[model samples]
Target: MGDVNRATTAAARAPKQDRSRATRQRLLEAAVACLAEHGWAGSTVAVVAERAGVSRGAAQHHFPTREDLFTAAVEHVAEERSTALRELFPQGAAGDRRAVVEEIVTLFTGPVFRAALALWVAASNEEQLRGRVTELEARVGRETHRTAVQLLDADESRPGVRETVQGLLDMARGLGLANLLSDDTARRARVVAQWAALIDAALGAPEDA
Candidate 1:
């Protein structure tokens, strides 16, 4: 009887745990969408909760403050993006440097990046957000650079290789900023192609070469 009761209690708790996780995920995703579409001034816990189909109280339960919600949202999406990027090249980026370049650029041109940019703009003016945003960006930047290096099969021991990868990311970010107002697809494709060629040259050709 005792063993059966323990098993039943565990089973009952599983659904609740799953629901909590799902709710949290929904709030995070909704927060990102709100930040992307509405900007920092317009996005609030209440608004995100509405978008998430949850209550404001629930959202606050997960994230105590507005900053906590938005920051966690961005970081969560950033991690998801990183995982997606890695999954895109399961075999590793051994030979297809152009494909890698295009994908990396795609990361910046997406809604997640837009949401992060909104946070950045808000952080510039909001004293309370500046420190958290700064720290979050630094961590994200480091992870992105590390991912880029891995995807590009870069050797940092080689002179200027590190800078080249960082430059690629910086250029991609600039392209993302340009994309904020307009499509910029045609020009971006041209730039991506050229950058791929430049990377090939700088990285001394792909492994398959």
Candidate 2:
């Protein structure tokens, strides 16, 4: 019984597998909030540590480098936006086309897009963040394209679908920028409606237009 107890104790103390994960999360969330509030120039590892209520050394234990922290932060926010989009759309593979498109547009013109815009702006000024920003973009692009294909009932290999998806992404990005500048929900919806008409025409889907 003593030997068994020792073994259990050893296992319990075994480096706390992934114990740093929560710290990483807190740091990442802090990074995003800091970026949103201060923009890229004011976001520093020390500031993020203070924002997270952790010592700078503790934050460094989780994210050794500022680039790593920013990467994690951008990925976290992107994942959250992706999850929100998934929730807004249908559960099954098959979704209501009109609903999905409108919801997507609304999402793009809302909080998710605003956070992304901040990241984009920050990345534009910081060369170190450029690669991470590109990676985040590629991930979002692939996921968005996959969702669009599934919604449109088009083969991924189809030629026109790629262009359609690109156009939709461009439109969404533009709308997001508009939202940030204008802060007009009604205008954003109207912008989405315009894109909806164009997408409906391109997709040959009658429901949304």
TM-scores for all candidates: the values are 0.96, 0.80
Candidate 1 deviant stretches above 4 angstroms: 206-209
- Residue 83 in model 1: lDDT: 87
What do the candidate models score in CA lDDT, each in turn? 0.94, 0.71
Best candidate according to lDDT: 1
Candidate 2 TM-score, C-alpha based: 0.80
Top TM-score: which candidate number? 1
Q: lDDT tens string, model 1, 58-175? A: 8899999999999999999999999899999997788888999999999999899999999999999999999999999999999999999888988888899999999999999999
- The per-prediction tally of clashing pairs is 0, 0
Please give me the total number of clashing residue pairs in predicted model 2: 0
Candidate 2 lDDT over 99-189, as tens digits, reads 5667666657655455566777878887887888888878877887676666555444645756876788777777777767666778766
